[model samples]
Target chain A: MDLNTVKERAGPREFSPADDLPREYREAATRMIEFHANSEIMGAYLERPFIRQAPSIDRKLAFSAKVQDEIGHGQLLYRAAESLGVKTREEMLDDLANGDGKFLNCFHYPLKSWVEIPMISFFVDGAAMRRQATLRRTSWEPYAHAMDKVCFEEGFHVKHGEDILKELMTGSRAEQQRTQEAFEEWWPRIIQFFGPTDDKSTHHDFAASVGLKQQSNDELRDAFLDQYIPKARKHGLEIPDEPRIRERDDGTYAVEEGDLDWDEFFTIAKNDYEPGLGQINGRKQAQEAVQWVRETIEDDATTAGGHAPQAAD
Target chain B: MAALENPADLDEREREALETLLKRLADDEFVLAERYTEWQVRAPSLESDLALANNAQDELGHARLWYDVLEDLGFEEQELVYERDPADFRHATLVELPFEEGDWADAVLRSYLYDAAEELRLEALEDSSYPKIADRVGKIQSEEAYHLEHAQNWVERLADGEEGHQRLQDALDRLFPHALTLFEPVDPDVETDIVDLGLRDATLEELGEEWLSIVVPYLESLELELPVSSQVDDDTFEITEEMLPEKRGRDGSHTDAWADLHDELTHTYRDLGRSETTKIMEKPE
Candidate 1:
């Protein structure tokens, strides 16, 4: 801790490759980074439609910046990961399109309207951030740094989501109905985002052995329940399942698990479930609509007219 | 537009010049914002995506202030934005062009080229006789200053990387002619009136020349060439009145893209049916 000792330890890395580190640690970081990065990248697919399809200017513009921020966050995380020894970002994305990579279950489902955004940003993103915080000290320096940067900015997103949710949770009857329904639809999936039960094999030991994650999926889910369940109930909206409680004779309370709607839950969690079929189709239509631009890049690469002449022809 | 902070003192030409200047500023900024908005959630890189979103918001913010002026000048904010037909929109062809999806090259080139033009326009406005407009021009200029730098960063990065250099060349070849057209003259009479009123400090050619001065050096430094000045031609598919949907957009000329934008931008509001029917929490005064 002395200054001279600190200085002695400082300066450039004196040498390189002392160790490969743990495979579990390394690979988990890879999965976590790619998972987070992909989440940021594809997160927009679920958001923009709601923004573009918003029934009002204020809502449209409001959603615009948040969606943009997410896409940007994807960029930031990707660049950070690129510096790490993870899979190339291009490969990661290919994995995404192929469905080999999974996004948060919250994104797989649809946002039927603006109310969905509040639930997503607040409840879902709130859960994601809590789980994400556990990774902030990840053995992989790059991911840890990226998470540090991201967690700071994410507060705005959560607050923005909460603001919208609060407006509706207390608003007119239609607004309340819409909010309640959306919350119910989203809770389990959002809960599920902490991920499936700790397999203790692929998810716990092997995953850690390969550096796929620093925390267990169940712990992350528990963190979410710890953080949001009370808030959900406080809104006077019934928690869709029975109140998780502890039974006691002379004592007060103990924790119990409430049933989740699995049919819907796993539908989004498992790849086969296309909860947002119309949305996926809508997105594909949107993508095809802009093919000319992509083709232009490929085309420009092949031709001279494709390159801009600097002198001003 | 917000009653001028104090409106009673303006002369007629001052007001007219202000009005003319506003439409140009708003059209240019709004459409530029819209064009860049395409990259929202979809840019090839997240950093670039965020930057694009940042710039788009900047353009829209610029439009908002101009719209504020129009609202002051007696126009509804939404109508001023959503109702104009294609022919009536005076944004340069550069800002109006649809960005090909995932077209990182075009997006970089267009931003580099248009930001150059915008900086010149802002500089000209900063010297205008309209005091309030000049103040805004100054404030907007601060943000745009970074935009030029950011675009220049991408342009240089593209021009420097092995693949980047080639993409820059192709982007230049395709987008240069369009870039030059960003200097396409405004209504000549309107131009003269604007200059005479001292609301714009320079003519289109002068501003174009001013833009070229900075851009030429930057591009040359990167060894990425541009089209020859003599070969510059306007081959734009200018969206005209015919391009708009049946009833909307200036001159009714808009691509289907515009219609999609309109719906997304207005969906929530439209669901409200009438503007006055719903009320969000009023921001405290």
Candidate 2:
């Protein structure tokens, strides 16, 4: 299909792999879905350490399940991206490991302690879920289908994260204080999760025009702030004064875009942020270490006729 | 032996036998699950990562169920896990050994060996005189079936290629001796009590023999060597005393790796000075 025809026909689940789409449409969807797939992986990498560090068996189990779900989401999304025929899963993952792939800005920063967990799990994930809920109607059928499963499993994650927040807020003075401090530190980064406002975002116009993106950055950010600002207060976490947020007459919230560190966001966007490079290389080392295993399995799948049982001794 | 239904009325000997058996079961699952989490995001593929993570959660859930029974004897999750001495753990040393980086072979081979033994052990507990142990076995065994199948599939595929076969060989040789510790006795005398009191229908030696019969033939079929002798066609397998590791975990002796793992898993609990562990899931009904 031509660009004009594609733009006109864009609607929920309108596009599939069978379509003879123009290059522009395919590349745009691939870039958007690949970024999303990369984010799921990077996000899981960030949360993995906490699986070992969880203070309780139940919490550890929940964290492991959540991280596993993120990897599973990555799997679904890569397939969705691959459906565009623009890139393969291996290439996408390799780009992520090589620091050439871009993901969400929040994942670039390190998550240090248990107190910082709910910051990512609750606030960051909450923001992502707000955006993803809209993408359930995305023009790419596979991407939207993947979103169906992602949205189903993500509710548990957001709730589990919030549960951690609730626990920390009600904990001892030291625990509560530490959690609040973590909130203040992470608040700006969480706000940046929606990315720059509509005017500043480079790809938003084409993506939305094609129906791949259902809502603008400004709309998603405002929606997230409205839902989560009170949650922070209800949990006794004082919203950081900076990234000055204002409540509108309709009671929705808006972040002072000037207050967020866009330079840092863009640096992370370029995969040049110092800490993010560590994350990228760390995952790369892990992937490289397991390269032999992947090769072994891949070779076996091709060579073996059909999983014939090993000859009995 | 009659089923021992009430936890309150057990005498000293019965209590010791029951508690010792429970610790052995719980510690094995808990520690193995802890090791399995090392593969969370680092496994060979995303699908593999998810599979291993699911296995980790399954084993941990089984550990939770066993630990819950110990609470009937006045143990709390804090005392049972977070605050317990590493040396006090009664898991086989095989589960505690650290995974070599990029060693998918070790992960799969270890799972195959451990899950094979686990199937036999759980079956022995299926008719335990301790009613709680018997009741919980069915729930645990159902999940364990998938673990064993998953492990076998991976191990077989890994053994197919030249390099994978060698990797599987190396993993098997290193892991074989430690795997025998699965059947080591906590106290030789208490082991006898476990059988006599009907806490498990099979003795450790019996379970060990059955495990060898299954795993030896399976691995040898894939051209992997065992550290012990097995005459597969004749239905005879022997596990000599020398084949067992010096630090058999069942007796509260463990490799150095177990201590480091224990410290790491408990770091958060200790870091947060508050006294208790949190419970997110409702107590397993």
> For residues B193-268, could you state the per-residue lDDT of candidate 2 as single tens digits?
9999999999998998899889988998998987655664447675778888789998888899999998888887
Q: Native contacts recovered, in order, as a fraction for each?
A: 0.38, 0.78
As for candidate 2, its clashing pairs are: none
Model 1 lDDT per residue over B248-269, tens place: 2222244465556555555555
Predictions: Cα RMSD each: 8.0, 2.4
Model 1 error, position B162 (Å): 13
Q: What is candidate 1's lDDT per residue for A1-313, written digit by digit as tens?
A: 3333322332222111243443434455567667788787567877766655544334545667778767767767776665556577767765665667656667777667776777788887788788667766554556666677688778877877776777667766777887788777766666666655675234565544333356787667666676676677776566765435443474443234345555665565445566644444554555454444444444444564655322110
TM per prediction: 0.72, 0.97
Q: What is the DockQ of each candidate?
A: 0.23, 0.60
Worst 10 residues of 1 chain A by lDDT: A8-17
Which candidate's TM-score is highest? 2
Per-residue error (Å), model 1, residue B26 = 2.0
